[model samples]
Target: MPIRSEWKLAREGWTLDTTTRLLKATAFNPLITLPLILAAKYTARGAQVASQNETLFRTLKSLVALGVLGSISGFLDDKVVNNWKGDEWDWKKEVVVVTGGSDGIGKSIVLLLAEKGIKVAVLDVQPLTYEAPPSVQFFQCDLGSKEAIEATAASVRSSLGDPTVLINNAGVARGKSILDSTEKDIRLTFNVNALSHYFLAHQFLPSMIQRNHGMVVTVASLAAYLSAPNMVDYASSKAAALTFHEGLAAELATQYKADKVRTIIMCQGYTRTALFEGFAGKSLYPETVAEEIVKAVLKGRSAHLVVPESSWGIVPRVRSWPLWMQYGFRKGLKNLMKSWKGRQVVQPSETQVEKEKKGVEESAVLVEEH
Candidate 1:
């Protein structure tokens, strides 16, 4: 489905997110900030030497100082997050695997990669909303079923070669209170949003470790840190996904000694998608989210990105705030999703459960033998 023009205008114009664009270019783009820093330095010096207005000169000096500090801080942060290593990603040789790529942000990612002439394998239960390009292949798989993921992984390898990048982006949300959520609802949320990361990594990470050249992008949400009512299961699953990304990054660097095998996790705010159809409050465009993920992959670096960039300072720190303050923040979001009419409830069928149990039993045997 095409994005409406009014939504595009709203996103681009002076709406709630107007500042995000400025922040992206200035605070986020060091390339842009570096030039500004130099210009500010020269201007400040000229004003000081020419005996111009003291207040103006002081303000310019302060701006230059702040710019220099921001640039240095960002550079150091990038080095730490990316392990002080560099990688040259050859898009021509990269095989990208994106789960739930039939629509929404996943689909946008697939298309963006395909546009760059990268081979893409999309795993989803539904078919693509549009025609698949020559560079794109679609695989139908139910992410909630472990067996299906395994079978799909094999097919992806055979069809597109070993995946150089694995995006664990498939997710489901059942908007129900904890007491109202059934066993199936809770299990399905965890299976797709959390455990599938484990299963997919099991299938794909070994090759990355051996080659020391790959990326794993986990698409989580801000809810991972700030849990609200009516979506407790979704928040819990995302939190688990957060830990999975952290643990995977550690194991790659420490256990496997694969520092070049990059891992990125995005804990973004609400995005405009079918999954969040009637969502209220400020939201991000699907393309905006996809563009950031794709740029990180092409750069071949690990990062922990919080979308809108403006929320980075606050969203992650909510957990560390005072108890009453945290409670108040969550309480204010009580009605944020009150009008949500997004994706319908997800059901983990009896057949899917039996298949998952079988997969678990087989995995146990393999582990014991190994």
Candidate 2:
């Protein structure tokens, strides 16, 4: 059997993020540097006694200094980002709403939350793929419609109380060039992948602001940073989603005075799911992505996750590179989806305009009789 992508990520000393992980461990946890400091001192003493090797002594000393500096820099970064306040997690009282929770990464998140005895409301167009526990409740929803989202929000509030966590995990991808994609395809892609964030935020975020508590997790993709030839709509929406997450975090702190209300955006690499069924490159296991999301939620802190961790350095810095370099890199992605056997085109039951009108009519009575 072939080595699974998720397992491959965990390979010792060889994974994409292995070096990053080690550096992070050294930087964030000073204890990791203790051994390195000791080794430096030992090496310095040996070099002096054996050969008086100044180069060998200097190298070890430099490593020790770099380690210490990294640790301090990491500490300051954490404190500044979090505003020096720590998270106070109370999982028992929290209610989570996960969109697209019927299957794939969303399903895994639902199960994990349920296992922890958390109340989870699942909003998806499809039915649950597996039998859900009592803690999990499914709500059929077309995420592409703002009106549908409004109606569903009312249902969730009534059934599960106000949600404390909202995971915007539902998404649709139409692997087509700009010319090949119909207007409907483009609309549906943006509606679900990007616009729903606004609708959902309108419904639930006010409550979070009032209580000064909540979390919003946006599941974007690596494509958010790198645009491929066939994924124009997908990339654009994800980029919007990424910015939405950043702007939301800023607004929570600066505008709403709700620093405790955390925001997380996940820029995940390719994953093994219906979304990327025939993707040629290595794709992560959906469970792997879900585990990272759940873990971040449990910590009760704002985070920006670039999964496979190796892509962390490369993805975010793409735009900063030279024009030719950026062009060359994206040019390489032209054939990324040539083998794409995923949902090439998604046709929604109702058009966006119709859904909006119907949503308004259903949710609020238009002409009230006196």
Q: Per-residue lDDT for 246-265 in model 2, tens only? A: 89988888999988888888
lDDT to native, each model: 0.79, 0.80
Q: Identify the leading candidate in terms of TM-score.
A: 2
Off by over 4 Å in 2: 1-14, 22-53, 344-370
My TM-score estimates for the predictions, one after another, are: 0.84, 0.86
Give the clashing pairs for model 2. none
Error of 2 at 31 (Å): 3.0
The digit string of per-residue lDDT tens for model 1 on 246-363 reads 9988888889999999999988889987777666668888887887788888788898888866677798899899999999999888887788766622223333554575532222
Clashing pairs in 1: none
TM-score of 1: 0.84
